[model samples]
Target: MDGLHSQQNVDLEEFRRRVQQGNDPHGPVRETLSRLGDRWTPLILMILRTGIMRYTQLLKEINSMADSPVSQRILTLKLRACERDGFIQRTVIPTVPPQVEYGLTDLGQAMVQELNRLIGWLEVHEVQINACRAEYDAH
Candidate 1:
């Protein structure tokens, strides 16, 4: 097999070993993906890649750019989840009223590179994916 297929085979083997439907429902990879798989998580994580942003800035970015806009309550939940997962950092500055900001942690920064590649792959394959969906629906 070519290198790409060979690597994918190796990855598949690794995944099989790590994740069992019954025994290991929440393996490291699976669990991590579960956290990141949420629509808001990746959006929040990626938005922080640019640098530290206040809550309103993050909210604005997601609402303006993402297909599904988030309400303040939902945004709070997603932000808390990301922070709990160690993928993002939250800072509360003490001032007249106090200010809150968010940014990526080291782990989150590393993941952004992979996220970018994943986005690129999706862009490349989107047409084929849509075509497959259309064909599948037609049949």
Candidate 2:
């Protein structure tokens, strides 16, 4: 198999093993999912993948991609959550007006790579997935 497919399978097997073994693997898995699996978190991460961005820049960038713009309060909450989870680093610059920037941490970068792998897999199997969905819907 190709390197990507091989790596994907290996990762899947490792994940399966982790989930299958031990008594409470679900707790850790669920914690991770609950932390990062929110509606806006993925989009925020995807934007951060580009480079460091100021708060307003991130807000505008995400808003451009989203059909419904996110509220400032919600954005603040997401950023705080990402920061708390150690997925993103928030840097503050003490200027006359105070400037802040956000970028992916090492952990965040690793998560982005994993997300890429999943995205690649989805791209590869999208047609098949659509076909299956259609078949199921017809039945």
lDDT: which candidate is best?
A: 2
As for candidate 2, its clashing pairs are none
lDDT scores of the candidates, listed in order: 0.87, 0.89
79: Cα error in model 2, Å: 1.0
Q: 97, model 2: CA deviation in Å?
A: 1.8
What is the TM-score of candidate 2?
A: 0.78
TM-score of each model, in listed order: 0.81, 0.78
In model 2, where do residues sit more than 4 Å from their true spots? 1-28
Q: Which tens-of-lDDT digit does each residue in 84-126 have in candidate 2?
A: 8789999999998999999999999998888889889999999
Q: What does candidate 1's lDDT look like per residue over 21-85, in tens digits?
A: 42555555665687678878888888899999999999999999888789999999988877876
Model 1 lDDT at residue 129? 99
- TM-score, candidate 1, is 0.81
